[model samples]
Target: MKEEIKKHLENAITSYHHYYASGKLAAYIPALLEANPKAIGACILDKEGHWYCAGDYEKRFTIQSISKIVTLALAIMDNGEESVFSKMGYEPTGDSFNSLVRMEINRVPKPYNPMINAGAIVVTSMIKGEDNNEKLERIIDFFKRLTSNEELSIDGKVYLSEKETGHRNRALAYYMKEVGILSLDVEDVLDLYFQQCSILVNCQDLAKIAMVFANDGVDINTGEELVPKYIARKIRTIMVTCGMYDASGSFAVRVGLPAKSGVGGGIIALSPKKLGIGLYGPALDDKGNSIVGMKVLEELSRKLDLSIF
Candidate 1:
């Protein structure tokens, strides 16, 4: 059964790789302009610890917005859910991932949830550290544990480029500071946020991390708690409700998995007790999610009975 499932997934990946070149790579961030717009990869880790990879699974990609999951995980591990929720939020708002409607309407102005950009900036500040370096290391360490890989770190070029052009994130930071929701210095918090987004991982590493979530935060091999079970559940719920930029609802309907995507053409999604999957393709839709990646997931869901509901 495992081998047959793997073959079907690989065939699907091969059939879909060409679709990436026909779409748009996110060009607003100049650093992302050069990714082979034609590239894609997919990997799945089943509950039994077997690995299956297809297409460019080894291709290196930055996590980009997908790092929100990492930073949020770190904040939960350090501060516990209660403290983290007090500052950010939990409900999903139907706005752009970076939209600030709540800040404009609500007294506090933080967004509806931590999965979006504003809430993510707030979550970034929640990590307990005296300085940015310490905070960043904690995030990195968390990623290492999730992926079981020690070498994960920021892509220097992507980090520099994003830092150079992160004006909107800067605005979110300052406004969050203005409302007193964000307790850290605007500059310091922005620095850490940028650094976190630049953390690099490929499809397989992301799949391994997703496997931890698939197992409800227990590492199958080590029987260790990488994240508290409820914490993992909360994060995955957010992923289902708000992980895709503006298309999260539609994605949930079509793909039926709790997943998160990044502008870097990377997505980490998982089927509980079944598989954790990662897909990458540099081309993007207007909402900043990978176009081919989304299609691949939709097809995978239809064929594999992987949807949650």
Candidate 2:
């Protein structure tokens, strides 16, 4: 089974590599432009501790928006569900992930969901910390535990790039602050949010983290409950509904797994109690998801009957 899965992953990577040309690097973030647009990788970790990997699985990239899931989980664990949800809704917004239009139109200007930039910023504020440094430390620590990689840390270049050029996110944070949705200092919240987005990871790291979710919040090897069962369940539900930005609905029909995509060309996906998948391809479609990564997952899902729906 290991050999078979590895072969399939290799085939998928080969078949979808050309799709990189159909997409472009996430040029808006200067640091992301440094990624090898042609690099495509995948890893699958099943419940029995088997790992099948192919392509450029070792290439590191920023965790990007994928950090939202961890941050949301940490916030819920820090504050009760009721407290967390009071700042953001769970509904999906068809708009772009970074767009602030919905906030402007709504009578109550809170972000529609934590998956989007506005909502993620608000959720980051909910994380208990005395300062941005402490909050960022907590977030990085959570990520390290989730991936079982104590070496996990931020990409300083990417963090600096995000902090300097993330004008849109800054706008969202300020608006939420003005509307009374955020009680914390806006710059501090944005700093923590940007810092979280810049945490470095690769396909293998992402797969290990996804495996925890696959096991309903428990570490597969150690039997440690990394996240409470209810919180893990809620995170998966939100990923299914909103993880792929505006392209989530179509991704659901085509792939049928709970997954999240990052602009850093990484995607984390899982089939409950079956397997966890991690993919990376820096070239992005219009929706900011990894184009090659999406194609690879679709092929794998079809071949392995891995779709949830």
Candidate 3:
């Protein structure tokens, strides 16, 4: 059965690889711009530890905004639910992940959710650490644990690139601070947020991390509960509603799973108790999601009947 599934995926990869050209690479971050827009990869990890992969799956890239999912989970685990959500809303913003228009228009101006840049910055500040370096170390360590990959680390070039070009993010942070939504030093929190986003990983690493989430926060292999069950449920709900930025609702109807996408052309999604999928494609649609990646997932979901809804 596993071999048949793998073969099906290989055939699907051949069909989807051609769609890469329709989307463009993320150009805002100079380092991310260097990625080969044509490259595509995917991997899946089943509940029993079976593995399947195809097309540049071994290639490494920065995780980008997908790291927000981890940081949000870590913040909730470290600071508890009430403290974190008090500063971040649970609803989707229905705007670009980095947009500041809503912040200015809303009366209270709390970031709609932790998945967006403004909200992510606030979530990073909730990490328990005396300094920026310490906070980053804590985040990195948590990622290593979730993926079971000690070698995972930030791409210095990408970090530097984002730090240099992330003016909008800086403005959001400053605005958040001014409105009292963020109490930490803007520079300190922004530094951590950029560093976290630049953490590099391959499709296999992402599949493993998604497996942990698929198992409801308990890593089946180690039998260790990484996140509280309740927290995992909340994370999954938010991913379904807001993980894909403004296009999340459409994605939910089509793919029907709790998933997240990153600007580095990576996506991690899961089907409860079934499998976890990781995909990468440098080309993006108008929504900043991996264009080829979404098509591939849609095909897989339809073939396997993996939709939760």
Q: Which stretches of candidate 2 lie over 4 Å from their true place?
A: none
- Model 3: per-residue lDDT, tens digit, 1-309? 798668867887889898888998889998998999889999999989999999999999999999988999999988999999999799988899999988799888899899988899999999998898888899999999999999998999999999999999999999888889989889988889999999999999889888888889989788899988888888888999999999999999999999999999999999987898899998999999999999999988888888999
lDDT of 1 by residue, 1-309 (tens): 687778878878877777776689877678989898888888888888888888778988889888888788878888888888888667778787877666789866666888888889888888888799888888898899999999898888888888898888888788888888888788888888888888889998899888888888999889999988887888889899889977998998888899999999999999987788988888988788888888888888988888999
Please write out the lDDT profile of model 2 over residues 37-103, one tens digit for every residue.
9999999999999999999999999999999999999999999999999889999999999999999
Give me the runs in candidate 1 sitting further than 4 Å from their true place: none
Whole-model Cα lDDT of every candidate shown, in order:
0.85, 0.92, 0.91
Best by lDDT: 2
Model 3 lDDT on a 0 to 1 scale:
0.91
**Which scores better on lDDT, 2 or 3?**
2
Clashes of 3: 0
